[model samples]
Structures are given as structure tokens and as C-alpha cells.
Target: MNDKVKALLSILESAGFSHDDLAGTVAELNDAVNDGKSTSIQLVSPGAAARYIKRINDENVFTARFRHSDEPDLLNNESNDERIENPNQDSCIVVSYDPAKQ
Candidate 1:
């Protein structure tokens, strides 16, 4: 899977958020004038995604995911141990402004 998909799946798996729990998920993004809305079924709630990313970032499990071979940073003798410190900006998903996918 792509990094975003993998990262999210890892978060969900780690958080014990099963596929059933995703039924209530809404990809929302609220701003000063709008109450946020659903952008797509293929996306996750930006707020929730950011929160989980941050929470999991501190966990050792997430640290291993970052160093996994599929990512663009590792090899025989070198590695990048950078962590996900900014979930809001680091997440591949985009927030919405439409306020409703309904």
C-alpha cells in the first residue's frame, strides 16, 4: 500500500478501530465560517487522522513503520529515523471546505 494508506491502516489497527468503526467516520474539515463537510468516501476525517497520527507517533510501533524498507529512506548502511511530528501537515489526506458530502 501507499504510505498514506499504510500509515492510516497502521493507526487504525493500533487504535483497535476496526472496519466497522469506520462506518461512523466522516472526512470533515471545519473553518471559521463553515462547519466542515465530507469530501469523499475514500478519505478519513482530517481531525481524527491528525489526532491519531500524533498519538501513535509517540509509540514505538509507529517508529518502526517510519523506518520500514518500503519507504524512501533506508538501505544497507544508512537510514533516516525522522518521526511524524506534524500530523496535520504530514498526512497525505486533504481537509474539506464543502461542509457536506450528503
Candidate 2:
């Protein structure tokens, strides 16, 4: 695996995702590459991503924000102020990857 994939897997693993839970995500990423398109991996939940951000000691490898699924364009800043000020179950975290970037 490339360094980016390795890093992402490490983050997910640290976030408490089991290997079984990551199988589908791995498959999806492979499929996206085969099809020549960019892709994003949706974590198990917003809470899981939040846990990773809060618990992991690494310099931020991923950006987390609060975005309501229905709004799509409405995302809080990278600082996550909105998420902290107002938690919403309707919001979901979208983790997008740029494979071309090292």
C-alpha cells in the first residue's frame, strides 16, 4: 500500500474500526481507482471521526467538520467550532482523499 493508504488505515484502526469494518472501504477505494475517479470514505459515524480527532496524537491528517446531509454545502469550518457549539445527529462527516497528493 502507498503511504497515504497506510496512514488512513492507521487512523481508522486507531479510531476503533475493526478489520471487518474496513473491508468494504478498502474495496470501494480500489474500485474508485480502477474506474479512474476520486472518492471519499464515509466513516461509520460522525462520532467515530470525532473520537479519532480527539484521541489520536498525530498532527491532523484529516479534516473534520459538521455538515448536515441535506445541506451538503453547509459545512462548519475546519476548527470544528460549530460541532462543539451545537452537536447535531443529522450532521455527518465526509472524509475525502486526494491520492495524487503526496
Candidate 3:
């Protein structure tokens, strides 16, 4: 296996996947590739992948809010518990994981 494949397998193993499961998945993937099908895999940090797994298994949600401004004073005010309404940029995202719902 190439370095990338080896790295992915290692990550999966570390994430508590069984050897037999990995082998079966690899076989299926190989079959797909041989049949001229395209596949895509994303590599992420171990911590991020672990968090994703935990969220999915626990059926949890992750939410985050971000604000951006070119002014230094605005950022400093934000840290002081001041709300900057309608800043230069603001965004909020919510992600929920529930395989059963899918």
C-alpha cells in the first residue's frame, strides 16, 4: 500500500475499527476501483476525526459562532464581553450527527 493508504488504515485502526472490518472495506473499495468507479476520501487530523466519531455515535451537535473585523478595537471589545452587532463579518454554524435520521 502507498503511504496515504497506510496512513488512512492506521487512522481507522486507531479509531477502534477491527482488522477484519478494515480488510473487508478495503476489498470492497478495490472492487469499486477496478470497476472504474471513482471514490473520494478526506484525511483529517486524528483529533478532528475522533470528535466526529464521538458526535455521530452520541448523536450530538456542534455549534460555533465567529466574528471578524478589520478594527483592532472591535476585537478587543468583543473579548470584553461586548456584543458587536452586525460586525464586518459574522457567521454561525450548527452541525448535528444522527445516522438513524439519515
Candidate 4:
């Protein structure tokens, strides 16, 4: 696995994504990145990767039950898959959600 795959897997794990569906998600994400649909996620770049991962968890077959409601809307500006570079500044500042309220 390349850095993208590793980053994806790490994000998935942190968000508690479904293990059963990971293999397919990994393959799909990898393909998306390779095919110009999605890009590699960066964990060290001021929460850009983390935000993107949260959005992925909300959508698609591999659902994240504990998904964040206030996830930053970074995808809207993401025409291609690359680090947003301090995404929190360019993105919406949605407030955090309560896990118990969900």
C-alpha cells in the first residue's frame, strides 16, 4: 500500500468505519485517487485529511455511524484530491455535534 492507502486506512480506523467493508473501500478510494476522482488524504495538514475522511464516512456504502455532523465542508472546494492547506480557514466553521444527541 502507498501513502494514500495508509492514510485512508488510518482515517477509517480512527473513525471506526465498518471493518467488513474496508477492503472494498480501500480499493475504491485507491482507484478514485488514481483515476483523478479523489486524492490522497494528508493527516498532518491541519485537519484536511481528517475532514475529508469524515465526509466519506457519512456517505457511500461504508457508513460511519458516529459521523460528525459539523464536519468541515472541504469537499465543495475540492475539484481534485489534494491537501487543502489549512482547510479550516477556507472552509465553513460548522459547530461540533453531540454524539449522544445523534
Candidate 5:
């Protein structure tokens, strides 16, 4: 894997994010990079990645796939499961638009 990917994955893992969480986080970060929201081609470093991940997670920036319903049966249902939270929650992954480049 590339340095950016490795760094990002390591950072996420250290911040209590599971492998699946890292996967989604990487996807979102890639999208940001592709969209020109972020200028850097790769994650700065494992330290930088860790800091960013912690910053985002602290901001409670996460998205989930399922919604909870107010039903006693559903609460007890075995099929009920928490949604897979999205990596782009609460603007955790920050993208600062540099006007100097404009």
C-alpha cells in the first residue's frame, strides 16, 4: 500500500476505528483528494494521520447506515444492528480551501 494509505490506516486504527472504519475513511479521504478539496497527494505521515483521525473522531464526525426505531419488538429483535457509521461525520476530515491558489 502507498504511504498515504498506510498512514491513514494506522491513524484510524489507533483512534479506535476498526478495519472497516479505516476503509471507509480512506475512501472519503480519496474522494476529497480527487475533488480538489485537499491539495496533498498523500497523507503527510503516520503522526499527521493519527492527529487528523483523532481530531475527526473527537468531533464525533461519523455516519451510520441504520436508523433506530421506537419499537419494543425491534429493540429485542436479533436482526437489529447498529448502522455502519460513515467516515465523513461532523466534518471530521477537514479540507481547508487555500485562496492563495485561486
Candidate 6:
């Protein structure tokens, strides 16, 4: 997996998203990014991601839910597969990797 996949998986894990849901969400996000529909994504805290998702809707960037609570006595809270696009956020911050340094 590439950095994007790793980051997406990490974000989804932290947010409590299920493996099944994560599969679709990651695919969608990766598609958007690769197609130039959206910029790169940064893994953030769940709360922060939620807030940011709400703030950005329609235009550029978007977010996919990746976590849910595990409930034994009640139904689990499903991760929302919502995408938020922010026009203002139109840049991808990436750094060149040096394998020799590793």
C-alpha cells in the first residue's frame, strides 16, 4: 500500500470504522484524489475530522467516515459515508521520499 492507503487506513482505524466500510471509503477517497477531483488528505483526530467535514461541503475536498462504536447491548453507530468538499482547500502538501536515507 502507498502512503495514501496507509493514511486512509490509519484515519479509518482511529475513527472506529469497520473493515467493510473502510474498503469503500478508501476506494472513493483514493479515486477522488487520483482523478484530480480532490487534493491529498491528512489524517486527523476524529472530532477534528468531523468538524472539518461539516465545514467543507461541495467544491474540492471531502471526508469519509471510518470508525464506529462497538456496542454489545445496543446497535453500533454506523460510520457516515459523507464527503465534504472545500473550494478553498485546493492544494496537496507532499514531500519527496528518500529511500536511501531510510
Task: Arrange candidates, best lDDT first.
Answer: 2, 4, 5, 6, 3, 1
lDDT tens per residue, model 5, 1-102: 444445545645665556764565477655654455533221223223435544433432221112223211222242434432443221233323222343
Better of 1 and 3 by TM-score: 3
Please write out the lDDT profile of model 1 over residues 2-71, one tens digit for every residue. Answer: 3433444556555455656553432221121133322322232333454554554454222212222223
Model 6 CA lDDT for position 28: 57
Q: What residue runs in model 6 are displaced by over 4 Å at the alpha carbon? A: 39-102
Highest-scoring model, lDDT? 2
- Give RMSD to native, each candidate: 14.7, 7.0, 16.4, 14.4, 11.8, 14.6
Q: Number of clashing residue pairs in every model?
A: 2, 0, 0, 1, 4, 6
Relative to the true structure, candidate 2 reaches a TM of: 0.51
Task: Quote each prediction's TM-score.
Answer: 0.25, 0.51, 0.32, 0.34, 0.33, 0.35
> Which candidate order results from sorting by TM-score in descending order?
2, 6, 4, 5, 3, 1
Q: Which stretches of candidate 4 lie over 4 Å from their true place?
A: 38-102
For candidate 5, the lDDT comes to 0.39
lDDT head-to-head 1 vs 6, winner: 6
- Clashing pairs in model 3? none
Local distance difference test, each candidate: 0.35, 0.53, 0.37, 0.43, 0.39, 0.39
Residue-level lDDT of model 6, residues 1-102, one tens digit each, is 445555645644654545664575466556655554543333223343443333232211343332222211111222354322442222211211222322
Worst 10 residues of 4 by lDDT: 92-101
Task: Point out where model 3 deviates above 4 Å.
Answer: 30-37, 40-102
Question: Candidate 2 residues 9-51, lDDT tens each?
Answer: 6776776667688888767765655555566665535355665
